[model samples]
Target: MARVSQEHLDARRRQILDGAAVCFARNGFHATSMQDVLKEVDLSAGAVYRYFSGKDALIAAIVGEVLDQVHEGFEEGARSTPPPPPDALLASVLSRVLATKESVTVDGRPAFPRLIVQVWTETLRNDELAAVLREGYGVVQRTWARIVEAYQDAGMMRPDVTPDHVARTMMASAMGFLAQQALFGPAPVEVLRDGLRGLMSVPDRGAGSQSG
Candidate 1:
């Protein structure tokens, strides 16, 4: 048999991942069967197994892809010239996330939010998946932390707040907002902006205050 080229292999893998993402999102990790995935990709069981050993492996890949997309969004936000101000950086990150929500569709359905929830729940029950999810979330938190630290160092943030604290708070707020929007409907961007500003804001410490 003629050997399949690397390019062909990668393309096939991407197709499988895309199909698996849609299935996992709609039926969820626990509810979804290998056959459901097979139906999505129109591939044989053996063909699907070639890319992913089983449902767990496929779910892991789908979650990893979602994390990668989020990372890309942050990278795009960071690349803005002169870098965005603290407020702009937060907004930019949120905007990128929203943009991804709008753009990523599968089988005439929006799957990202569902996929995210599935990954979160599954992570609690599965150690390997939990580790991957934790690592991915850590990367996101670190990215925001670095941005917060830069602003703090530059005197843009109130000196009383630590970068790690601000970063964690901001991420928590963003995740909550995302959950609300996914469960309800789209929220006003201004509401998110205000919430983030409030979390990152520092009260003015008078010049006479001792510099810790």
Candidate 2:
């Protein structure tokens, strides 16, 4: 028998991960069984183990994939604009997230929100998972902080605010809103936009303050 190429192995791993995501989205992390994932991929139990040692590993991969996609989306959004202001750059990042929420689904459900919730819960119980989550969140915070510092340099943000503080606050606000929307229904984007504008201290093209 010939050894499988790295490309082939990666493709197979991705296929398994996709199927695992569907199962996880539908039945959740703890409730989902390896058998369910195997059935989704139409693979034997042994085949599943060849790629992922167990459910915990698979869950980590799923969460890692989601974070990677988000990072890619933000990078693409930032690159699409040549040299926008910090506020505009941050808005571009937010737009990509909103677009992702609209486009990506698993098991006929929005994956990011459910995935985030599941990962947050898992992080509480699993140290390895928590470290992965912390790294992803650190990337997010640092990215936002850099953008905020740029905005401050451009004189777009108030002098009193620190970039790190603003970045943390922005992340907290976005996550909080997403949690609310997931618990209830779709949140009004305009409301979120207005709140963000206020938080970022985006200068008005016209003369006055806008009410939220």
User: 101-191 in candidate 2: lDDT tens per residue?
Assistant: 5534664556566656666777788999999988987887777666666656667566667878977876676677667655665656566
Off by over 4 Å in 1: 1-8, 75-82, 97-109, 186-191, 194-212
lDDT of 2: 0.70
Looking at model 2, which ten-residue stretch has the lowest summed lDDT?
Answer: 77-86
Span of ten consecutive residues with least summed lDDT in model 1: 77-86
lDDT of 1 at 202: 59
Q: Could you tell me the C-alpha RMSD of candidate 2 in Å?
A: 5.1
User: Local distance difference test, per candidate?
Assistant: 0.73, 0.70
TM-scores for candidates 1 onward, in order? 0.77, 0.73
Pairs that collide in candidate 1 are none
